[model samples]
Target: MTDHAQEQEMEIEALEAILMDDFKEIDPSESGVSTTNRCFQITLSPQEDDLDASNYTPVQLALIFSHTEKYPDEPPLLNVKSIRGIKTDDLNMLQEKLEGEAYESLGMSMIYTLATSAKEWLHEKYGQNVLDEVVEEPASTKDDIIIPHGEPVTTETFLAWRERFEAELALERAKLMPESALTAPKDKRLTGRQWFESGRAAAKGPTTVPEDSEEEEEIDFDDDFEDDDDEMLEHYLAQKSEKSAEESKN
Candidate 1:
């Protein structure tokens, strides 16, 4: 193979490995780099906390990368496709920013750089504060619907809120229950006694306490021990009183 062809193959392999490691999925039809041509598409998802708790719809975007024959020496063409929840102007701005980034990375592997830039742009444009941009009007008919904090109240919003609340509540309840209780049939709710019984039955391991240790023996609160304790307490009190008296006098 020619030196340029080998270089192209090596670069393609490195790019493929980067994509596989970074993204959960990539379509081969949309991603490839060869001696003659190079093109790839990557889908970027918004962060988990990007949407308002009530907003069920998530924002996603497909970034298509097109490279010239002189790629790695020249910048790649970046196009935004399948965009959701962002304005056209915003997307244009993102494209401009990415183009600038590619130009800045003149002679380096630019695929990972482009992908990282796209993700950061998505977070900035459509993350947790997305609702602030959506509900621009001062008032609307949808205002009457009560929603959870950081979420707009709609049918989907209410459902998402309920799901989140239930998940958090279940976690709290699990904290109070024994580990053995978690193994019980989820559909069957066990009473307090039943929970105790299940836990007791599951605990078949040897006892942690020593069989006949002196520490476990009953203590004798006899007069001699009590007298000694009282004397020590009196001595401590006397010393404390003397310290206080000296400080007050000073």
Candidate 2:
């Protein structure tokens, strides 16, 4: 109905598109504040690249806000909550920082901007090795220690590791190939290891039918029958030749 309302509507749509599952419209009562306007919350986490650097405790937080009746003219009411592995003091500090930014960002759609700031802060504060200090130690490492790598290989995982090793060696040799050969390769090549990933691999050895297979038995039976028929024909021809010779002699 008003310019402020129109701006809020557009910003909400943009945030929903960008944040996907992380952004959601929450009940007004969830804000714990008496308000006639819409309230919403955004889940925030540290950026992904930094999280991959080392073992770290997962951290998350929520940025909850409500538009005032005259949003954009007045700053939105903001709050921060520790969703995971965040301390109370951290939430207070973030709340004050976001509220200050809200005032500074008055007369504009500030929720998305505030969410971005919160995410960046989360990354800087908790990303990489910084989270090691806050990560919880296992109750017992001797028994309860989780595997750091992936699922362990089973007996059924008869991988052709030798082929993969040879392939890798070949790849290394290929790297040392002539400059002209490298420039225009004959075919697209993928390593055996690459092919063997994710349970989708070719059989390691040549495919073989079982020794007790009925197909092989059936083939052997047909061959034996053909051999017997040939022997009978040879015997019959021999007898006919002998009889013709005796008749000619008489």
Candidate 3:
């Protein structure tokens, strides 16, 4: 194969490795085939070629590989687009801050974070309260916005936090379920108004016999045979004596 073709092949392999690594943290199977394709598209971008503190975030750098032509050594043309969320002013500030840095080669996510510490600067300069408020109503534009819309933030950085947030929400739902279930009336497995409705239904239900009904069915005992008992005993004694005499003779 030509050197250019060989270079493209290597870039593809590297990009695939990054995506596979992501699969470790997230279930690609659950996400769908499109997710892998999307990841590939990002990984093959020209922005990846210029990955550095000056050029892109870790996510942006990872995406560059997939954007390159199959023959990479012919000089890949970058149609690099930033992800949404970063504001336009923020992008200017980021570029100014990253002036001296140049991406020699790509590295892991942490390297990107370290290289682009612009977020940290923004927080420190603007204060936590202001930054938090601005982040909520993220700027929506394509004017090469730096922080929010310039490029999508790496999922490695944000997805983990999002998953934890989701888990906490699920836990909160679970916590409420038992309380509702326990307070629920026998006729229904819900609570509050439903419980009240269930209680009404139970009140209208069929009347069952009392658990002690067997005891109520029992009859009282009496000694009515006592008067004839003595006479019977005397007769039995006389018969017993006659039988004894006959046995003695035999």
Model 3 per-residue lDDT tens digits across residues 65-179: 1223332323232112234334557545555453323232322112223233533554354433333443355666665335755555665768987999878765543443446
lDDT by residue (tens digit), candidate 2, 1-250: 4688788889899999998888898888787657857888898877564454224436878898888879988988787888777888878888888889989988888888999899888888776545555657667655343567977554344366666776777665454333554565447443323322211213234447898887742334345335543343444456568889999999
Location of the lowest summed lDDT over 10 successive residues in candidate 3: 58-67
In terms of lDDT, which candidate is stronger, 1 or 3? 1
Best by TM-score: 2
Q: Which stretches of candidate 2 lie over 4 Å from their true place?
A: 49-57, 129-250
Q: Rate the local accuracy (lDDT) of all candidates.
A: 0.62, 0.70, 0.40
* Model 3 misplaced stretches (Cα beyond 4 Å): 21-40, 43-74, 88-250
Backbone clashes in model 3: 21
Ranking by lDDT: 2, 1, 3
Candidate 1's residue-wise lDDT over 11-88, tens digit each?
Answer: 667767766533333443554323234556676756654443334446777787766667677876667764466777
- Pairs of residues clashing in candidate 2: none
RMSD of each: 27.1, 24.6, 29.0
